[model samples]
Target chain A: MLTPLTVALAVAALALAAWCGHAAYRDQPTKDWHFAGMAVVTALSVLQLVVGVVRLARGEEPADSTVIFVSYLVGVVCCMPAVGLLSLSERTRWGSLTVVAGAVVLAVLQVRLYDIWEGVGA
Target chain B: MPERNGDTDGSTGTARAAGTTGDGGRRLASGPGRLLVTLYGIFTVGAASRSLYQLSTRFDEAPLAYVLSAVAAVVYAFITVALVRGGEGARRAALACCGAELLGVLTVGTWTLVEPSAFPDATVWSDYGMGYLFIPLVLPVTGLLWLRRQPTDGSERTDTTSRTGTTGRTDGTGPAGR
Candidate 1:
């Protein structure tokens, strides 16, 4: 995993979380504009996922087991889209809160992803 | 179903239900239930994945811990499913499951604390889920509070029966419907 990119992704996820939290505070559901933010973070995470996969394919070794690392990589990519869709179905401030949950989770996952590569806690 | 369904049994909810009954409909996953589901789903994945990896690669290192992690994962999964299913029955099941989760966490947390030597390594519920920021301890308590606040079908039916004088609460103003 790229450390800089992961950091950037985590920052973006937190930004999205804040944005969604604002919407939830305002008693509004996540609107189209919020989804644009979701797309950016999701795209970046997916790009990171691709990079991680390519590295694995080239027989580059992470600091730990590939399975744990890859699961987290794949899991990061799934968080926003799943939550975004789920939020779409909800149409309320809680829907916005749902996005907040998703974004925070993704941000945390990003940190974990970085740690896995750094073997910080492995 | 709105997460902020405060005074849900009062006249305010009766008035409010007129507007949101279509979506929330008193389902378990409506309103704040969505938040609970999100949290529980995340925990399920975290606990399940961790336990699976540990059991596969290092069971001998901490068999009890790994098994407890798996058990916690299962309880989390059951609660998630119950919330999503969303009904009086589902609510009751989720309520029961949350009770079990709290019991498990307290048991495991206390066990690990009282007999530190018994747990060579940490499980999710160790020290009351300290590794996970005590979320394991906090989550079940939250789930239980939320689930208890939700009006069951029978209670809602009794409520509606007196007010609406409706014979079919199954389709009419819900004992469960928002």
Candidate 2:
């Protein structure tokens, strides 16, 4: 995984989480703007996924077991879209809160992915 | 008061009945329950996949820990499904699962602490889910509280309805609508 891209994704996820959490506290459902924000995060995740795969295809091995790293990579990629769809079904402040939770999870997963990648060489 | 009564009676009777029986009542995936379901779903996936990978790849390293992780994953999956299905039966099942989850976490946590060598690696509940931000420790407690708050039988519904009526009479709009 690209270190800079991973760090960027974590920051974006947390920032979006905080934003959604504020919206939830204000008793607002996930608005269009929230979807847009999620889209940006999801786009970043997709980019990471593509870059990781491309690098792997070109003989770049992760620091650890390829299975575990690949699993986490897929997980990070899928997290936002799943949570976003789930939140869409809910039309209350809790929906926004769900987005916040999803973002937080995504951020954590990204950090884990980074650690796993780094763990192999160090 | 009469207007509020008429409105609730006309519109919400089915909703109330469904909520009570889980036949057609409010879905467990509705409102705040939605949030709970989402969290449970995440844990279900996380625990299940993690355990599967560990058990398949390195079972010899820590058999006990991997088994416990698998158990935790199953419990999480059951609870998630029960919460989503809703109804009295599902609620009871969820409550039971939550209770079991709490018991498991406490038991495993204390066991690991009292005998650190017992777990060479870590189960999901080892150290009360420290690796997972203690969510495994807190989640069951929250599940129990949320389940307890759900109206169970007819009597509870009547009690809530009466309370709604009293508030509606005084305020001219039932507080329950929101």
Candidate 3:
């Protein structure tokens, strides 16, 4: 895994989570700005996905189970979009809260991916 | 839909009736319940995939742990579906699932703490879901609370009557009364 990219994704996800958390606490619905923030995070994840696939093509395999590593890579890319759609349907403070939860989950997944990758390489 | 129906007198009575059913039972996916559903959905996917992968690839290493994870996945999936499909029956089913989930988490959590050697690997509820920020432990508690807040079967009549009274009086105010 790309260490810098993973760290960047985790940081971005957590920042978005905190922002959405504050909005939810204030009883606000998810706004266009929230979507924009999500887009940025999703873009980062997509980039990571592309880079990860390229690395795999170059025969740079993680030390752990390749299946698990691939699954996490794909899952990291899917998380934001899925949560964004779910939040869009909700249209309430709870919708914002959902985004907050999703972002935090993404951050956690990123950390886990890093750990798993490190485990294999080490 | 209720908001639109509240505009027409002809539809008001029917809409009010429907609203009573809705508000009384409180659609499991409404408001805060939506958040619960989303979280449960995440857990269902997370636990199910994790358990399935572990069971398929290395079950011999930790059969008990993988099996427990699979069980948690099934329970999460059931609760997620029940919450999304709101009704008297769905509410009851969700309530039962939440209760079972709470018990499972507590039991497994304590067992892991007491006999760490028993689990060669961590299940979803191990250490009270410490690995997942304890959300696994807290989820069922919140789910039970949310399910309890739904009007009971016996109290449906009273709930509908109270809801009808409020909606009936605020006809001109539109859906704002809701």
Per-prediction DockQ, in order?
0.19, 0.33, 0.27
Residue pairs of candidate 3 with colliding backbone atoms: none
Worst 10 residues of 1 chain B by lDDT: B157-166
For residues A19-48, what per-residue lDDT tens digits would candidate 3 score against the true structure?
989777666666777889999999999999
Model 1 lDDT per residue over B4-95, tens place: 42332234323432333532325466556667788899999999999999999999998999999999999999999888877677777788
Q: In model 2, which runs have C-alpha deviations exceeding 4 angstroms?
A: A120-122, B1-25, B154-178
Where model 3 places Cα greater than 4 Å from the true spot, the runs are A120-122, B1-26, B153-178
Best candidate per lDDT, number? 3
Instruction: Compare the candidates by DockQ and give the number of the best one.
Output: 2
TM-score of each: 0.83, 0.84, 0.83
For residues A1-122, could you state the per-residue lDDT of candidate 2 as single tens digits? 78999999999999999999987777666667788999999999999989988988999888777787888889988888987886676655677788988999999998788878888422
lDDT of 1: 0.79
Interface RMSD, in order shown:
10.2, 9.0, 9.4
Candidate 3 lDDT by residue in tens digits, B1-178: 1121112222432343334553445456756777899899999999999999999999999899999999999999999998887777888889899999999999999999999999999999999999889999999988987776665442343332112111323223222212
TM-score of chain A of 2: 0.95
